[model samples]
Target: MMKRIALLWNVVKGDARVLWHALRQPERPVWLVPATALVALYALDPFNIAMPLAGVVDDGIIVPLLLHVMVRCLPAHMRRA
Candidate 1:
């Protein structure tokens, strides 16, 4: 469990760094901001799609998957090791 937590923390930190860099750049990809906003909105569950019991499961799986995809969609230059 600790290992998983540490890994998650590392990934979050790395993604945050990449996003900060992307935000500071003049030529950031057009999709970056909208995609990030979508992920944030989905995470907030404002639409209440997770009303059903199964919906919670969907949120658990989908949110992180969306985040992973969003980070992956960043330009190679924006991504770091």
Candidate 2:
């Protein structure tokens, strides 16, 4: 059990390093534009700030989509086993 935990931790650490590098690259992610727009919309909106839809979307769709997009956007070398 300890060995499995160690292995899982190592994998998570390595994957996080790769993701950090990919996201920190000079090139902006494709989703950044849309994400920024969404943020701006939220920021600019004054009435009815209770955004249940946004919370639901982010929790369900956006989170997974963002993760998928991030992995896809990684450099081939970084993603290589």
**Top lDDT model:** 1
Alpha-carbon lDDT, every model? 0.73, 0.55
Candidate 2, 1-81: lDDT as tens digits: 789758755755565456656556666466644654564464445432467667654444444444445556666865653
Worst 10 residues of 2 by lDDT: 59-68
Full-model lDDT, candidate 2: 0.55
**Candidate 1 lDDT, 18-72, residue by residue in tens:** 7768867888999888887877777777455537566666665676667667779
lDDT of 2 at 54: 70
Best by TM-score: 1
In model 2, which regions exceed 4 Å deviation?
A: 31-73
Task: Give candidate 1's root-mean-square deviation (CA, Å).
Answer: 3.1
